[model samples]
Target chain A: MQTVKMVITGPFSSGKTEFIRTVSEIDVVATERKISSEVEKIKESTTVAMDFGRITVDDDLVLFLFGTPGQKRFDFMWEILSEGMLGFIVMVDSTRPETFREARTILETFKAYAPTPYIVAANKQDSPDAWEVEDVKHALRLDPEVKIMPCVARNKESVKTVLLELLYGILAEMEKN
Target chain B: MALKGNLRDFTITQLLNLVNLARKTGSLIIEGPTDVAQVTFRDGKLAFARLGQTDSSLATILHLNQKITAGQYRVIKERAGKMTDKELGLLLINAGYLSQEDILGSVQQYFIAIIRQLYTWVDGFFRFQPDLMPPEDKITVRLDLENLIIEGSRQMKEQEQLQEEIPSLDMALKFSERPGTNLRNVSLSVEEWRVVSYINPKNTIRQIAKANKMNDLAIRRVVFSLLQAGLVQLARPEGMPVAPVTSSSSSRPGAAPLPVTNKEEQKSLVNRLISRIRSL
Candidate 1:
């Protein structure tokens, strides 16, 4: 069976682990530690190292999802997880517009390592205060060709839709090559 | 020359303790990635603190603490938006919503909260200028820097320990479907039971923290202890599929997977989302 490794990355509390847990067939294994500082206002615990999960895409192919810690202090793990990955999903918390800058930086960092396809998942779409997908796209300065999708990472179907999109992007890229 | 450097080298607590020991009077300004805050000290005690626009206002703090109703908060905020710090305090008192003591107490609480937050900043530049005057008529809440530092540091250390056990607040928790027998013999704290009442695999630790008005570390510590006692287990929400339901042994279903990059469909989704924002 062929294995495809994909990454789910974003800023703090951007729902990377939730997205992976939603779509993964197996339980997600995550290394989380309590954050003491002001970030405790956002969430108590944060992913310290990485979150891992896997899914079977038919008998011959399987998909593995690796979620990188949101904080920049953990950026060193980004390269480690991104290696040999087919593509990735950049999650963003729509309610926290301030995190958009970090989301862009993550996207750029991964793209620098490999020119792989990616989808910007605007999470927290259910929140009334969340930004519109168009506005998020504009704020992130995403090129027209880059796909931006709104998702509630907590929802299994929504997470599946995002993964499918990233998979499609990868397939199309593979066709080009 | 003013004392200035990255906070990483000299923590806010260390700086405050130094100033307090020397009995220096001045303003200590911290510039962080998201906000800038200035704390004035008179004779080595905290006189006043002014934070950048990103920090929560007194009204927000009051609202979060449930000291003021949402409606009352809105009115106060609308009326006090243009008022100075001193004027706002007066307005709150004159409106009969808060007594003089309440105002003072809230101010102190707000001050402590801001300092605690500043202690968490790993990357920031700090500057100290001696002999700066307090803002005009601003409420001056003098606090012993040594005591404040000790308390803040203690809380930070406690939070770090709790974080070691509790990973992320995004984790959904539920009473263990097969709880261990130890739960029957173990006594739970009032706070633990309160947290247990909220666990249903539907509420994340973050949501539970918000519901209880506790900070992240406080909630996680409670949850961590519960997990250790085998009373609760982390689980995904119900209806979330753990894996692909259908799979074949030898077929490459991904080769013909449903397409997600149809430009026309994406454009429409964006249009719908934009309309939702406009309606708001």
Candidate 2:
């Protein structure tokens, strides 16, 4: 049996777990704990360790999805989760502009760890006040070639689109090699 | 739907860039914690702006600019209360009290000032009402926003860099042990001196900023300069409670560090993944 790994990461509450759950065939194994930080009152609980999900493309090819915790304290897990990954997705809350800076930092850090294929998923696009994908791209200071896809993690179609975009990016990199 | 969001998530600079790039025509209403601002644009060009409930009338602007005397300003306020800005401006121009250029220039300056003030507002709610125009009676100008956008973008970049350098305003600052040069010999700006005077291990950068009447950006800039000069370093505020460490476990801990796949194997795997995703 062959398994390919893909990691999902972003700032706090950027929908990394939801994105995984929306597509994962099995019940995602999430290590969630009550949030203790006063600043993160937006959510009741946050992923403490990581989220594990899997998709069986076929009998022989299974895909693994890992989501890293978002808090700065859990930054050590980023490198560990990123290891041996085929590609990664940097999710950003489209309605929250303040997280854009952190999103950029996470992207840079992941890129530095491994020059792997990745795409930014601007999640929460369903919100009325959500920033446009182009605006999110500009705010993130992303290069022209870096794809930023609009996503709503709860919506399976949107999640699929984001995952497909990242897969295409990986395929392109593979073709180049 | 109206375009609306908090300033925390989308800055005034980014909003302006969007307006300019999209050539949007509307009124951007920003509600700050204490005040409200309305900026009008036509074809993406700045036309007018008003802050709070203050008088942004042509006569008031002229008076504030010293184009009119105090007595004239008082009389105009008393008698021209019913006149619209356009009517007042035309009346002034006809009476030779002010030239068209003077009125337009003053209005432009006032509008720009309002926009500049908006930049300092980090926490606010802004909503763009598309196709909204300023009052018909109000005088408007067609000032290009390109320069303002450029200036704002530059300031935003500087502020971001400063914030990155000084991640937390709650963090205190302490003078470096080895300055390599005497602090007394070093030339410092008035703002820098003020910040330095408040530099104590007990006083967080936020406290220093509050004492000096400096905003987050100002304090960060000052502290960042001090840090770059080796004059001060960030330290935990005295007696502040430390956060408890939370350990995280990574999945597949004992897995290989790097993907162990030949080009052919990777290609086949990617193709299979792509086919599966596309079908989904």
Clash counts per candidate, in order, are 4, 1
Best by DockQ: 2
Chain B TM-score of every predicted model: 0.52, 0.75
Candidate 2 residue lDDT tens string, B37-145: 9999888889889999997888889988888999999999999989988999999999998899999999998899888888877788988887778888988899999
Best by lDDT: 2
lDDT of 1 by residue, B1-280 (tens): 3355666555576667666765668898899757899888888888778779753566776676677899988887797766676777777788787888876677777777788878766468876776566667567777788888797678667766877777567778987766355655779998887898898877888888778876565687788889887788887765655655664332111221223456554444333322322332
The candidate maximizing TM-score is 2
Residues forming the 10-long window of minimal summed lDDT in candidate 1 chain B: B249-258
Candidate 2 has what TM-score? 0.77
Off by over 4 Å in 1: B1-280
